[model samples]
Target: MKIIWTFTLMMIPGVVSSMSVTGYSGGGVNITCEYDKKYKENTKYFCKGDWLSCIDRIRTDIKDKWFDDGRFSLYDDTRSAVFTVTIRNLTEEDSGTYHCGVDIPTGIDSSTEVKLKISTGQQTRTVRGYSGGNIIINYKYELIHTNHVIDVCKTSSDQCFTVINTNRSTEWKRDRRFSAHDDTSAGLLRLFIRDLNENDSGEYKIIVKVSEDYSFFSEFDLDIKTDDCCVKSISLSASAGGSVNINCKYPQSHSGDVKFVCWRSGADLCAKETPVNESRRWRDEGKIQLYDDREQQLLTGSISHVTEENSEYWCGVQTDQGHKIFITRVLVSVTDTVGPAAGWPVWMGITVACVTFIIIIIIIIVLYKIQKKRINCRSAIDEYENYPRTDPRTDPRTDPRTDPRTDPRTDPRTDPRTDPRTDPRTDPRTDPRTDPSEDTYTSLDLNTRSSDLYDTLTTVHPRPAVHQ
Candidate 1:
């Protein structure tokens, strides 16, 4: 039974027409399916997989109008007898066999099988040019696609809108800056772009259609660099009452040329006073001083006492009589405060350094005073411990008149040594040796009472034999 089924399947027609399409991931594709004019009003459907038992993706009921569903869109051009299907934002998973079918109620329907292959590779290249220059780009394709529609476009946001294409005549001159030449025998498409500038730097696409609706493209990134003629948009700043020095560099070949600093009114017009002769020493010319250092290939100009009126100036080298090629543009700004061109003004940096130095000095002074006080207190304590006070007249405890044992007014009942509140060992205020706070004050008190303490300890008196 399986062998018979296989034989029967082989005998059936797979598809009435077939074609292959190529697309890139993250891109889109358009597929045009041509059908007979007799089925113009019939319902059409686009499906996936085999045409006989295909899964329907989109079905159109209207004629000559587009029907959109998700990423799939279908349009039936009844007059041309062809319908177009568009798939957007394609991925590798979208690569499969699809069938464009026309539904018929009577008998078999008409179907066209489409094989889509999605590739994941970059087809881009880099082409570089200079400012104020021209460039030519040549794209090669298979000779079979030479007769197909070719386009050159600027790619932006995944769209390749045409700039120049073969849909027009071979001698098309709609845009003078852009031109195209189709070399059919060599299978080359040559594109010429004249007088390139910075704004022209971007990605360009060359697309060649392989089928009625499907085409592929290659990308080129154009990079335009600055020319040696001049440096553009240079900003320099100076104070309102000060002078500004303008320094511009030129090529070594122009070392012998006369350099100048003049006011530029137009592209090639220098309006202000003519610059002085080139000299190694500064030569005065009106309010400006000019110096041309040929050995260093440098042009130096200085404007003294610049005001707001001295804003725009050009530093250039004279190539011939009454013609100068500007090497650099100078935009001078006059302001009270310093500008960004000179970062962190000198006065501000000096003030910060002085404040930091003063803080460091104050820290050192505080630490030195604390260390000296500690050393002095230590020496006073050691000296006060070893110094003696053994004299009877000076030492109040050795005098009989002041003795508590003999004097009735100072008896043991009132003696400070006997009463706990007044005893030297218990009373914190009376006994300086027992209290740590009192000991701290004693070191400090020595600074003011050192002489009185020394006088009491040094005074002498004779000892009594029997005082009590």
Candidate 2:
């Protein structure tokens, strides 16, 4: 006995006039319908319905019947009018016969049938790209029944690209992974690993199948690192009247095989020395020079008679990979003095001698004035003793001879000369010998005691006295 089952389908108003099935349970199915047959002028079989109308009808009426528990659902490419049924979460219960049918308005209808048989094991496939624009495919593990094949489509620009797998041991095993054909490409095919692990870090092989019989392959390695280059430290030093030196060291990771070294001050790099090149006189305004050279060590050239102008001197080094720089400064000053040309001790002695000479001249002038006063007093006394007597008759001041009356009676004991007033043969007042007007004393002979004595002796003693 045979049992027959019939399922009724429903349609949405105004949008759909027909229904059909596009794909089935174990993956082999094809369905088509007449949405716009006028698009193909001679295709009279598909003349009446719009494309959206046909798709809407299939989605509404047949979608529930095709559900197969939770394994399948309806999909439509709205831009292309292609309706598809996708199977997922597959199970053995989903296997069945599918009927696709479309109802025409003039009492006519079209139908097609597809059979589905679900397999018990998993089937695997891979995608790859190749050189010369080809894709290579190798399928492992047999399916319970043959499944329909479709090209791996690039939704963008509708251009088909390829991928490749080169491991022969896993060529027939569906567990093998997929990879791009060439590691380096003119256009890169970026493979994004969601949660990358250590297993993701090695070389990857890519193969591309150009046609059913031809293929290409390449390999590439990926390396991962966690550390970066760093500057270790820098230092500077300067001495009086000398060039400053600056030292800079970078971490070993960054300094590994330095090719060349350079020095700079501020933004300008110092000129280098060569075998044929002569040294530039006073280069960089006499502020910089080449000092030393070697694999990793350097020194600055000697700077003579350094001055304030060199205060801003700097040093630097350049390596194969990077550059480092530093600066140092030096300061200088000189001594000075003030006062008299001679030292203070010599000036003090000269000032003292000048003061002593002036004091000696003042003492000599005081002694000379006292001696002159005594001489003047003695001369005045002598003039007083020689003054004539006051009586005019005997005063030499009147007759000028034997004038005892005119001469002063000087004390005999004091003067020791004979006093004119005490003469023996002369009268005090009237005697001729003593008279003030007589010439007796004036004419007296030195052999006679007096002129009167001579006259009397001659008269008394007679003429014989005169002859004797």
Candidate 3:
């Protein structure tokens, strides 16, 4: 089952190579190598500048001169720098040291050494079958080395090498219920058995010898089981409106001595024993009822018109040794029997309507308040339109006319002293200091005729009204 392998790589001026060696049972072995670069021109079976070309030349020379057997060969190509040497069809006698070397014209040379080993392969076999049938065996042989091969045979005529392992060992068994077959080409070992019995359970050994010093051995165990004396438990099935069957099976060996009893618990306990078919204990509030007592150990309980309230009942078995119970506490809800309440939907609808009505009322109140404020503002503006503003500067109460001298235009009749047209107010002579009122008229003085005319008018006064 285990293999050891070794790989190595080396590089020197103008040359690079890698090698791998594997060891297996039966002295089988393999050696492989790869070169670094392709060969160039000026290479007569060996290129001076190319590393792989030099390696190819060395590989060809070694195959032809050292190991020229049919199992050894060399592979090389111009497109790939890689050069490989293979040794196939390995055997115990083929294990030895292998070397690959390369030489360049520029005084550079590289070489690698590999040691090949071989071992006897381990022998193993596999057998498969049902517990109650005959056992079958298969054998196979595997070689550990590349150039090696293994062969297995049996010592007795009754049984031959039914199976072999990787070590090339022979597997043999003396059991009459089992048989084995071998395929040498495919390295497959097959086993066959008919009417397998329970007693055929044990380990079988395989022995193999390669030459005189090399040998391989292996062992395998077989087990068989019978299907008898099995115990089966009870299972119960029930539905909403239909009855159920509760069944239990006792061991066939104890069918006669075993007694069966049925019982129910929860709210009340009721038990019925076998043989007598009499109820030993009973409590009733319609709590627990024994529906059917067939065979005593198994019972079929019916809950007529099963309802949610009666779903918490328990059913089980009771015997002289002990008691077993099963409680059904799952509340069975029936969709047809229970539905939405009659007034629930109606009440919900009314509630939603009321909520909507309240919202509308609130909106109306808000809008009314807004409109009322607008009307009040309009009325205030209308009332303010009737009033007119008065200027304080032109009002009579604060007028300068209250002071007669301060008035720029005064009534001419009211101020006789200041009148310039009055003759009595003026002085005719050119006297500078005649009168204060006539001082302003001094410049308008007229001749004595003008003064005489004024005196005549004064003297010619009209007659007063006689009859008044």
Model 3 TM-score (2 dp): 0.20
Give the per-residue Cα lDDT of candidate 1 at 190: 66
Q: Which TM-score value belongs to model 2?
A: 0.21
Off by over 4 Å in 1: 1-14, 123-147, 152-162, 166-174, 180-207, 217-468
**CA lDDT of each candidate?**
0.69, 0.32, 0.39
Residue range 293-399, candidate 3, lDDT tens digits: 23443333223334333333333233232222222122333333332322123335468779999999999999999999999999999889976666657766566
Each model's TM-score?
0.36, 0.21, 0.20
lDDT of 2 by residue, 350-401 (tens): 5766766777777777776677777787778877887655776765567645
Worst 10 residues of 3 by lDDT: 40-49
lDDT of 1 by residue, 1-468 (tens): 967755654554545666788776655567888888999999988899876678988998789887889988888999999998877666799889998888887878888888898776333356655565445566665555555677788977645567777663454333557767667776666676755688888988776677775676666678767657445446887876556767777667667767777774432224585464565877776667777788887777677666676677766565432334444668888888643323333335468789999999999999999999999999999999999878898688788878888775678676665776676577764454465544444455555766654454334321123457
Steric collisions counted per model: 0, 12, 40
**Candidate 2's error at 186, in angstroms?**
35
Name the weakest run of 10 consecutive residues (lDDT summed) in model 2.
128-137
Report how far off residue 344 is in candidate 3 (Å): 71
